[model samples]
Target: MTETRFYPKGEGMTLAELAALCEGELRDGADAGHRVDGLAALDDAGPRDIGFFDNNRYAAVLAETRAGGVLIARRSVHLVPPGVAALVVRDPGRAFALAGRALFPDALLPTGLELGGISDRAFVDPSAVLEEGVIVEPQAVIGPRAVIGRGTHVGAGAVIGPGCQIGRDCRIGWHASIQHALIGDRVILHPGVRLGQDGFGYSAGRDGILKMVQIGRVIIQDGVEIGANTTIDRGAIRDTVIGENTKIDNQVQIGHNVRVGRNCMIVAQVALAGSVTLGDGVAIGGQSAVNNHVTVGDGAQIAAISSVAGDVPAGARWGGVPAKPVRDWFREVTWVSEMAKQRRVPEVRHGRDDNDA
Candidate 1:
């Protein structure tokens, strides 16, 4: 079983200290002397944990949590549990996040690279079978236990880690580093793509120092195409899975343990946090980011530059930062266009209008 550490339940900073750290105002609640440490989701909170609510949807769970205290915005102070201390903030989510970080910092990975790599210009295992059409370029390192299937092209300077499995007809681009990763058939990994790198894990000590530990692998299914400079981190615990036929565009950063479903189109510059789940056929536009552990439902469409901070239902089309439905976004865009119309230089219509001769 994975280690589950709890926060400092009763012996930690006061509500006042938390308020100061978040630069928030405390509204009506129990004494500021209340001690808080652990943080949990509103639905899964216990007496030792401090639950938070930024949106009204979680208001139902506010009274249900066994948490000793609650953190909420000033407007929702009335929803606080009876006799429970409240840490009021302008953004309860942000405050809770800060509190969680203070309580549980990530564990980092070790940086112990091998002393010396394989001597051969193209290092391949004897047990592994390569087809006649397969090409392993110079300085390409294929590990001792790795298997590169038929017609696969291992580009120059590519590093395939020990025990890796590359399927048939795959294109492993130049200078790509794949460690502890499984690549399926027909996959196209462009140059500079990094798969199965150690995740950014850090465990904070009493001395306020952090330690790193590498513990995971990456799994890419068949028919996937990863663009140039895209980075896919290995899992922190389980496998970071990219489903079949998924097209990930340039410069995307997919964090550890993420599960991206099949046929998903993740556009350029997208940042998917650790453990995020995307259902099948999801389309994420350029520069969008999904929060950690959030589930994006199937067939959902998110517009460019959107910041998704919450769950999106199946087939939903959303836009904007902290994304909402496209209908809501359309109204907002219309309003913005109306406001900015007068500020812009007036344009003369080239084509004929209704009054044209």
Candidate 2:
């Protein structure tokens, strides 16, 4: 259970109300009037909490949960024990999430210090423009000519560099450094997110490794959430654009001139080299690396730990080193493993070679 001191539950809702909110159906003499105020795992839920079961691995636990109500698929309704009200839904997981939001709305966003307005200890540049309702915390530095929109929260120690433009209702997390970026509304830059740093581009001149001037900016569209410690570089000639609604996981390194389309899911520890382009709905698994100048088309999925060296067509599923189609990759792996296994056979004494010295 979440501690009440840290997170308070919303007003309690009746079982009927929950069913309505989740588009679930309460069946078989369910006590619609029963009140629920908390949500918990099936194994830990008490009489006042709601629990959800989606996977068959938890079928045993579902039978014994003490929750006031349980969200389950129609096929599993028979597993519910007596005295427990079952809310039937197409997807138990989705229903549970909906119910959770209804009961714990505050848990939707990242928690931060509730500094109401500009802190007297913070430094706001004389030329910087901050709209009404913006909250700037202590030790934060807003550079000259920077514009932060209304209802945004700048967390402690955050540095909004000179000439940056941030839109409304955004949350700039603690210690985040934003330079040469234009971010849209409802964007969430989690703690330690580094945006618009110089890209890794250099030219070999007579003077030895000459660093190229990174003149472009990072453009983050609306509803984009960049996880903690993710660094996106500013482009050398064009803007590095992250499209709307892309959810990037923690520790991702997106290099210069990369264009990530809308609704893409990039897992943790993924590294995209400079000029890589990802179309809409693309999903790159954890620890994958996309080499520079490669493009992954829309709806493509690359498996975890894959090393992508070339372009992937739209709606493809690829995996393994130098990633290709998943089936081909698996077949090649199988063939190599079989050959290795064959080589492991011992050279019997009865089969001594004629050329043996």
Candidate 3:
């Protein structure tokens, strides 16, 4: 069954149009006049849908796919099923992505927000300043003295707290909350994102646990994209900073005063404890975590599920629990596997004495 989509279906396109849009060459015998109604994965595609095939591991699925056409690597075109048109490209994934964006332009663009107007159901404080071309959707709340720049869209149920400054061409997604934040132009906060929430700071005293107020802001630089349900806590003192062009995945937890440098890619469920600093071009894999006050140098890559507790040098790859250099981790794993195999005891024969002790 095809998955239900929230966005409206795109207008169907001819195979020839799709090939031109994706910068791919149509293989001979492909029906140029055939229309592709939608995009789907290899396993779920129907006769009128277009799909992509890049990995050889899924060659069986490609062979059975019922798609009208497929965006495929030039080397893998032979794997496509009979009757399926092959659009061969140097980079199949990139070509498919381009085709998807072109085909679903409206679905990819921001919706639900009224351009250059505020919905009647939205509440904007009298003192809040909205520049020209700002869009505030239904049930959105704009707090006092907040400044929203032109071409920004605040989605339904989104909250912009007092004194917040959001820059131009930004899109704050539905139900996302922003407080004590300074966001730069073209920043995209996906649905359910929580920015500037209070940091987990408390003092255990004789009287009881004393909560410390989080007064610092979250500074999101231009072109940053934060994924859904990701929470970035406000600093206890200094500001938490996300640098320009950083892309953070869903459900990431960034603690107080964490500094993420430009063009960093933090994958889903990654956690950075308080005061952690990441240099530019770092890539942290899914479910990994960095301990408090650790510094990851520029261009370092942390593998999935790693638990980093110390500083990582620039251009290094780290992995494993209490993360170490990836090569060292691999060596240790190999040694342990060999040792376990060597220690394995062979089962004794029981041919003559079932009851002997």
Candidate 4:
């Protein structure tokens, strides 16, 4: 016999009612009383599932969907099949995301330790404070001056190094290392993340080598989410700061003394050199590199494979090596192509050839 499993349902939302609640005009007649338990794609939706279609490429699947209701863009509203309830909107993707959050809210973790679970063999300093709802998993070490706030979760084999501070609702993933860092509320450090690591600093004297001291700290503000295996180096003199609500993707390298502003979206494999300053709401594409001491203004977008070498104006889009303005780069490309064409003209080519005589 198969074991029974329970799936939680959303409160007070039916398929037809959800479709009517959307601001877009409806495309087909739909029953407002039918219940929907979750969100799904058009192809994978069941009787109780609500699906969405944002692209016209999936119109065939949308027309055959059994979903109770479908959220679709205004342009795609005509694709809704008969007897299907269509929630028309300008951005179907964003609408779908909102619907998912409403249909399946995140459940909070239960508080306090429970019996029948194996505890880890780890060292927690007597002077350290672990607040309510905090969990320190097996083989994890909490230092003497460390304080983990309420609802914080530290995974197994992770090290909260000496003098570190972690705020409430934060998550430290497995095998991560944090030293002399200040992590804010709701921040997430994924597995294998390395924070506050010693920066590459050294001086070679006439006689021998001199190691430069790194006395700075890593400061991550509230609502920041760091991806797995990313490395954020500590500052050389000041703090390596990541502003609030900034999302960093996996395998990114943030060098010492980098200042990133609020709500920035940094994609994977990005390397920011030391002392780089990025204004708020900047979006950096994957594999982009910003040179040292460069400043990127607010709302600037750096496309993928770009190598930024100078200051970028606010709200501009930059690309290519040395990272010039997109318009200027395109103009230069057009000029070069036109010049090459002019040089290849038969009359011009013969004149230039005879001029050598």
Candidate 5:
């Protein structure tokens, strides 16, 4: 069983209410008035908690789950234990997510900065323009000529540097710094995110490495959510652009002049070197890295911890240190393992001195 953590419980909802909220059909085992007070994993769920089962990998766990009610696909409705209420849906995960949002609305929305308007402790420059309904938290700094649109919230200790153009309904998390950037609407920058920093550029010189002056800006499109501690550097020449709805995970580093297309999913600790271009809908796994100037085609998937050195063709699934197609990589691994198992040890020579030769 999964260990449970204590989260403040919300108002209890009846089985009928949950079914209505999630658009699922409630089976007739449990009473409609049965109260569900919390949501939990199958192993951790109690009589008052609702759980979800989606993946077949956890079939054994599903059979043994103690949840009073379980959300499951219509095909898997028979797997529910006797006495447990089955909420059948097209997608159990999606239904469970909707139920979670309905149950824990406060956990999903911003809390500290939502109710309060601009904080008295925040610093807004006289030349900077903030639209109506913008919320600036305590100790946040807004620089000269910065334009922040309506319904944006700048969290505590965040810095909006000079000449930045932030769009409407954006949430800039605490300690995030943005400079020389044009950000689009509904973007969410997590805590410690640093955007528009100078790229790593140097020129060979007789004296020492001469730093090149970065002149270009960072452009982030709408509906993007950058994770905590992610760093995106500005371009040396052309602008660094992140397309709409790209979901980047925590600790990702995007170098200068990089172009990431719409709907790309870059997992945690992924690194894209300077001038790297990713096409739309690319999914890069955790800890993966692409070399400088590489172009990854649309819909390509890079496996976890892979090092990509060249272009990946569209719709390819690649993996390994020096990545290759999934089939090729698996074949190579199998061949190597077979070779290792069949190899014979070299015959050991009796003690002989090199001087004899």
Candidate 6:
């Protein structure tokens, strides 16, 4: 029943092999030799496709699953069907992810071309230096004196500006424009990612707004994955730094000179203003905005649609407008909601008001 495959799939693996590959253990005397050839959801997975159940919302369907194998937590092992093999782990979601990664490695990380060779339609300047095993696709432009490291793939219509240095095994997506930037190894720049562009720097005076020439660079460290259509502006004086292993979602706007710490997670539509500093392991929810010059401490969690106008302490959970402590925000919201429920309390003394629902 599996159809419409976009990429090549790996060979089928046995239940024992999948368990070992995902660092999981089989439970309830499951047959270790059962073969699983595809991946799918619990309802769609067949006898040959592996499925996963980690969320409470899908608990009801676990008992009736027709799949031969299921990845689930130790606590949920009892819910597995009698004939199915249960692969128990501490984090079933992560284990399932590992299984998917092993089975379909290319799907997780798409290497545009399997064979390492530059396309004839691609344009590499005579002064550019491409290391061995680099793959350049059609319409890609590598400018003068650009140095692309080994095993990197430049997709169609991608533009690597002059003198830009990219490390090995990096993937530059289609139509991505990189200039005045230094990128590290294993970085993935998704389609339409615009880096090292002019920052929004202007001084207002009697003579009108004076644009400050953005001369600094953008430094993207190793293993950082930037999503599609996200724009990281070039620093005005120093450099816009995206720390190692940080994953930024789509449509993010990171202003000039913003320093994002390692392993930080910035969700989609988030805006980090110029000169803002995000400490390591911080996670900001979608559409959150951090004001300029604000510093978010390590491990801080900012809720979705929140605005941070001040410094956030380390490990604190903050939410709401102006972004205060979560508890305080909840309390304030609860109070306002409760207070609003008493409709026309002031008018009660003068006249009885009609109840409106």
TM-score of each model, paired residue for residue = 0.60, 0.92, 0.87, 0.82, 0.89, 0.93
How do the residues 94-183 of candidate 4 rate in per-residue lDDT, one tens digit apiece? 777767767665522222223222245767888888888787877888988898999888887889988799999887888889997999
Better of 3 and 4 by TM-score: 3
What are the per-model numbers of colliding residue pairs? 8, 0, 0, 0, 0, 0
TM-score of 2: 0.92
Off by over 4 Å in 5: 1-9, 12-14, 20-23, 28-37, 109-115, 344-357
Ranking the candidates on lDDT from highest down gives 2, 3, 6, 5, 4, 1
Candidate 3 residue-wise lDDT, 227-292, digit = tens? 999999988899999999999999999999999999999999999999999999999999999999
Q: Write the per-residue lDDT of candidate 1 for residues 1-357, one digit (tens) a residue.
A: 112452223455777777787777666656677666667676666655677887788777787767766778888988887776777788878887787666554311111122222335777777665666677877788777788888777787888888888899788888889998988998989888999998777778888858566588899999999998999999998999999999999999999989999999999999999889999999999999999999999999999999999999999999897799999989998999999986755445786454555
Residue pairs in candidate 5 whose N, alpha carbon or C atoms collide under 3 angstroms: none
Model 2 score (lDDT)? 0.94
lDDT of 2 by residue, 100-202 (tens): 8888877766677887999998999999999999999999999999999999999999999999999999999899999999999999999999999999999
- The TM-score-based order of candidates, best leading, equals 6, 2, 5, 3, 4, 1
Residues 251-347, candidate 6, lDDT per residue (tens digit)? 9999999999999999999999999999999999999999999999999999999999999999999999989999999999999999899856643
lDDT agreement of model 1 with the native: 0.81
Clashing pairs in 2: none
Clash pairs, candidate 6, are: none
Candidate 1, position 270, lDDT:
99
Instruction: Please give the range of 10 consecutive residues that has the lowest summed lDDT in model 6.
Output: 348-357
Tell me how far candidate 5 lies from the true structure as C-alpha RMSD in angstroms.
Answer: 3.4
lDDT of 3 at 241: 99
